[model samples]
Target: MTSTDKYIEMKVPAFILTGLLCGLLLQPVAAQTGPAHNRPNIILIMSDDMGYSDLGCYGSEISTPNLDSLAMTGLRYTRFHNMGHCCPSRAALMTGLYPHQTGLGWMTGTNFHLPGFTDELNEHCVTIAEVLKTAGYATLMAGKWHLSHNIHAGGPQHDWPLQRGFEKFYGILTGAGNYYDPASLCRDNTLITPLNDPEYHPQHFYFTNAITDNAVRFMQERPKDKPFFMYVAYTTAHWPMQAPEEAIEKYKGKYDAGWDVLRRQRFEREKALGVIDKDATLSPSDTHPWAEEKDKAAMARRMETYAAMITIMDQGIGKIVDELKKEGIFDNTVIVFLQDNGGNAEGTGFGGPEGETRPVVPKNAAALKPLGKDEVQYAINPPVTRDGKRVMQGKNVMAGPADTYLAYLKPWGNLSNTPFRKYKNFVYEGGVATPLIIHWPDGIKAERGAVRTQSGHEIDLMPTIAQLAGAKYPSVYKGNEITPVSGISLIPTFEDKPLPPERAIYWSHQANRAMLMGKWKIVSGGILNGPYGKWKTYVSLPWQLYDMENDRSEMRDLSAEHPDIVKKMAAMWDKWAHSTNVYPMPWKEVKPPLRPDYMSTPWEYPDF
Candidate 1:
């Protein structure tokens, strides 16, 4: 009997049946028994809270030679997008579905017992790791996993990496934390303290390097019988911008020109690099003039530290690439580098204070104290640490040292996003757009250093990876029916083909909504005042239309010019929101006041 017929005749459990059927009918072109060269390994690298232009190749002043080199040898997508926030982007990336479809339309915190805000990845969706594992690929993950809620309070471990099909996992379970002493770290479901725990001697640890080290170790120990899928997520360039002293010192005076000048320079460089069109106008600075700032030195220091963090992350990426080369897998490995979202504008242009606290040491302990030492906190209303250490929170302290916790904030965020408007948490281009670099020497035969303007989103990643790995999207997983993949494989784009003509994308977060059909887009509800101040209903908001092909920066609104088109797109968005479980914005159930600050920490939101 044929293999398909034999499998059909077998009385296997429904869950096992899907995998067995996949094995028999959808065998990868590069079978496990076949030559090793046929199946390529996959590595997906994501940066947290990174702007669209934060990488060297993508027009940043930051030193990202490793990433730039990868882009040079591969493909760069100028119009790639994330879900405009961390958890939502990650949910879409992992499950190939809209965030709401995977129970993560909002951040993973209190579920509020809502359909889309469950604070955990629902079983109905299958992760890329889960799907790839069924195709004989070894799945591994390292770094921030913000898909689960209340991790420290025994949150659903079943939604953690290992339970989602990653055979091995390491890194933080929460959305944001201090890089030096990250909380809620784990290895294969076992909670472990950071390497810099006080008990450990020479308590010097950086989370970026640690994540990369674990990733390389996973590669070295992975079984050679099967190809591997590695998801390396780094929380660098996020809040609590901490870096090693030496690294921070490298860019001490890099941003003295301030954000206004820096933004212009970055815009010019992007134009020169062809990443942005020559006519792309810079968005007016929403921040104060650098020259008028009284604290010029401190502002420069903040940008310097932010640059240092990104550079250090880049250094870690170099180590990962070197490890791949060492394993003789560089040529056959697909490396995708992207960011979770646009530059964050939390904590205003300058970060807010964490609150008052007893000094851990003398106020003038040192000009440059070691990171994770002072235990200074910011934007934490309660002003308490995990160990119940009462600490100060706020911008009273200068950023950079471990003792201080602060974000680069809005001015720098505006610069990081370059010519794009707005910052993270909005549906604007600057908020959702992110740089995507794909490198595969053996697989991608397209022209090197090619830039594609085709629009794509995080949801496309899983389906694209599945296509390249010859993995099947199982209809059933673990006896539960699985949501069919919602993304189209980007394989055709690798051959310089355009995205499908009927393609449509939708996004909604905190009542900020957008829908894109081909080159036309309609966006609404990002005003930060009045009843619409935060997460309000989208029905009362006016929808603005734009022809993305002509104005990707969303400079001109076409709503008045094309009322019928706007109406149609708005209807489509409502349909998508209803179908994807994105209706009933969190505000409808709970009208919590707008966050006092923009920092993404759980404590910042009273509702959490």
Candidate 2:
């Protein structure tokens, strides 16, 4: 029978939900042979700032055998996208609601006007944890938790993972920090010490390793009969790109060619591998002319460190997979891997708004120089004491003495974003588009190695997981009412069904707003600074449109030629924005602007 027909035949009536568990438990052994609600265990793995071509399966030359192994046994997605930043993308992924609906319409730093001065997850939404946990799955979270920081302030409320529906939580609370001595590490709601495991030889202090260790522990200790939902988020490959000397040494000379050459090569390789369209145009360089010079050695060294970080993270993933195999649960687990956002260009030397906070290690005076970036460069040799002891200084080189601190320079960062036009903070594809991989050994019907063209977004993940587990999301969770999920399931793609065209995908973070309908996209150069300040908070406009299907690089603007289409799409987009609680202007604007807020801005560079 067809899936819909089967659903109609098997769906329990509203009256049955209350006694469902009792009925299920009382069923005879022979009658319980079928799927227990199609409820397979769910494992979601997220990487940080990973590039489009950073995996072997995606055409990278880096050592990503583990990821490649997963691709060999499952399905790969080529056109999936995120909202383009961390908190926003994560909000969409977890709650299945648009970022605006979750009150994190922009990155935490955007300062978009909200009820409080904090940038925390709103109480109006439901998390995947709350839904799945209620459905009888044990939910656990590990890695970076940027949902809320004020939770630790001992205020009116706390917003850590436990408070948000997760049964177990561990990881950093903020956006960025030192990998070794991160500023914010928590168990439930209390602070903890850094990675000071003397038992582990040579003091191998790395967040990637630590997070993975926690992942394995959780799985090994989980009840075999109870299904699980694990969110394994890793902070590797973001900023503060530090790696072991041996790992960095492997790619020491790999990026000798400047970003221009590297980008074209990676794009061509990705096309050949079917990771992206063969005709997809590469986005143009967004850095200044001075930043383009070929510092082959330095550039290669920087990418080497970056590559090392990814490699290490992959190794950790392998361990987790191995543990599942040991428990004989590998075949039934559904694994989804993705990135929070695109590669970050805010180098280790970058600071403040341009650069997020990174950790600093103490160093001796001789080992110190002007702090270049916020983190350490893997290539730079660590300072050694007169006897030969390696300095254990933290990041943020300029703030302290030797053996006390260390930081990376900015040049390495220029290489991290590589071919992408903009850095982590912008609204460009470089900052938004990310790698998404899905693997299901026994559930998915698609060929093991097939790569589908259907477009997938962060919002789609929730609905997809819900459908897979046959879990019902409630209208209210944790005493707060919730908006229904906005995404459709991807099971259709895996089932080989015809995919639908892009209907309407709108974006707005700190006035960096954009809208995509079918092949056309509209973007403004700036946020919240438009003409006459109508939508006065988002005063940037002069709607530029790009046929994404043909102009994936977003080079040509057809707004003037297709004025009719632009107006129609613009109206539809504005309607969506308003419905989702987006401010007509920046949250800080004193006066509200006209509806639809389409006004031209005075300053704009190419590709906003």
* TM-score of every prediction relative to native: 0.85, 0.79
Compose the digit string of candidate 1's lDDT tens values, residues 266-333.
99999988898888777778788988877677668878888998988888889989998987879989
Full-model lDDT for every candidate:
0.77, 0.64
Candidate 1, residue 449: Cα displacement in angstroms equals: 0.7
In candidate 2, which residue ranges exceed 4 Å CA deviation? 1-34, 109-118, 151-157, 195-202, 287-296, 347-420, 527-539, 584-607
Residue 151 alpha-carbon offset, candidate 2, angstroms: 5.2
lDDT tens digits by residue: candidate 2, 1-608: 33322322333421133123222322222221135643578899988776666788886777899889888778888767777777777788888777888877755544546532226678888888887788778889889887774534344335678887788777777766556555466665654544322222225667778888887888877776678999988987765556767777777667666565666667777788787776777666555432455344444555677788889999999998998888887887889998877666543443344333333334356554432323322222234322334444322222212222223333333333333455455666666666777888777767878887676678778767766666676777767777766665677677667444533456766666677655567765554544322344444546777777677656788989877666766666566677676654444433334445587655444345
Highest TM-score model number: 1
